[model samples]
Target: MAREQFDLIVFDWDGTLMDSTAHITRSIQAACQDLGLPVPADQAASYVIGLGLREALQMAAPTLDPADYPRLIERYRFHYFLKDQATELFAGVREMLQALRDDGYLLAVATGKSRVGLNRALDQTSLTSLFDGTRCADETFSKPHPAMLHELTRELGQGLARTVMIGDTTHDLQMARNAGTAAIGVTYGAHAASSLEALQPEFVAQNVAELSAWLREHA
Candidate 1:
């Protein structure tokens, strides 16, 4: 497909646009430690990508008492917000987005993160204006639900066939499939290359550089 053929390109936050895996894992581990629970390692934390915080927390610390979930979530959020000011956008992300935008692709974000969390990241990275629209977990059904993608397509006044979803997890790929749009998975974020490939994205890029190339060819 020509780069300008797609009317909209939806993005997943966290591991997709930013390198927040270590920051997120460290914050969650600290929260678990404070609650006297075992801290999941980096690889384990990566496995929780694309799910809402509540679900990801449960998966990360399944041994924790169910009643303590709220407290754990609060602690994790507090620690994460405190340290996330230092979060950085992934290499080549800004240039890639600019390239796509200059090529006339409408950009949007569909993330499992809450609005506050997503806004904070965008502000920190000076990317608040890059997106034409955002659909967050707090405002819509979380992935792998297709609500956000569907909403974005409607909001953009574009059909699903003319849109694409780019993300780093199976949840994102599945969401795209569920919404009947093309999906591209990237491997430099939270999930492994083989794992994302198993979801059968239309294309899988090993890193941001390759992802930009793929977008150029398929967008």
Candidate 2:
């Protein structure tokens, strides 16, 4: 196969890089409990991992009143903060990102997290300098809208064809499709690899090591 030269690479947060899926799921559940609402099943909570927090909460608890959205979010933030400070990125993520950066690829993040949440994670990880750019769901449209990817490419002056989206959710792949860019799906995240394959990603990596290897040759 011919090597595809990509000028930019965008990553999704949460389950994509940070191993925060379980934390997010637990936070959502805790928030629901605090609101006296039915806690969403693990699968249900996991399903919304790549959506904006409002949307994720709504989807996970459809019966929740809009008036309660603020409280729900507050409760979520409470539980999230309790554990977020202890969270860490997935194994090999730092090494992979550093390798990609060393190879001269412009790295950016397009995540469903709010700007504050993303900034907090960046600061905690102290890996902020590794990324060239970033877009948060609260600052732009949520995943699968392509708005974040479009803005990132435009702002960075990278062509759609030469830009790649690497994520762990179908939302990420669909966003790449909407932005007319290539996508590489990572299986060890929120969504299943089977679901990712149905989206026809340019490549499907089972782990960070596999993803890094693929990028080493084709990115």
Candidate 3:
């Protein structure tokens, strides 16, 4: 804790900072149901939480023809936004991000959400200015690919060695690895703790409180 190991801390959106995992899972399932495709189970649906909508749908409704993806995506968006107001950031997330920023660390987001979708969430939460930069799946390659992280670091003028990625899914962790950066996983989101642990993150926090504490002392 003597020296800050990271200059930039990038976070995944849906499950990491926001409490939208269940909502996303429900939307995916509902979309499949609307398309008469097999509805994915909660875990199955949640597993795709950190990928691009098209990639997620490809996994969640694999039986459906590729041409029908637009239909599924439309339905999924309908369901997700129906209760969008109900989705809130996990407790203490704002404070944690503010504290990090106040301490002079550059904060950014690398999310699976589309540019439009991410903009909506950030605007609704009034967190637009807190981020120094952001990269969405629609604007770059999806998770587990290095493009998003690479772009963010390059934009921020931060090196891979000076950046850390945080999230609640294996895709997030994998993306960090692919980008040659450190990762911290949170268990209170889409993926299970065991799954995140298998990715070998620097830390696994159970909640925002725990995550904040770890970052305070170690980031």
Q: What is each predicted model's overall lDDT from 0 to 1?
A: 0.87, 0.91, 0.95
User: Per-residue lDDT for 113-155 in model 1, tens only?
Assistant: 8888888788878888878999998787878889999999888
Off by over 4 Å in 1: 1-5
Q: Candidate 3: misplaced stretches above 4 Å?
A: 1-3
- Kindly report which residue pairs in candidate 1 clash with one another: none
Write one digit per residue (lDDT tens) for candidate 2, span 4-112: 6898999998998999999999999999999899999898899899999998888888998898898999999999999788888999999999988887889999999
* lDDT head-to-head 2 vs 3, winner: 3
Stretches of model 2 off by over 4 angstroms after superposition: 1-3
What tens-digit string does per-residue lDDT give for candidate 3 at 24-102?
Answer: 9999999999999998999999999999999999999989989989999999999999999899999999999989888
- Candidate order by lDDT, decreasing, is 3, 2, 1
Winning model by lDDT: 3
TM per candidate: 0.93, 0.97, 0.98
TM-score of 2: 0.97
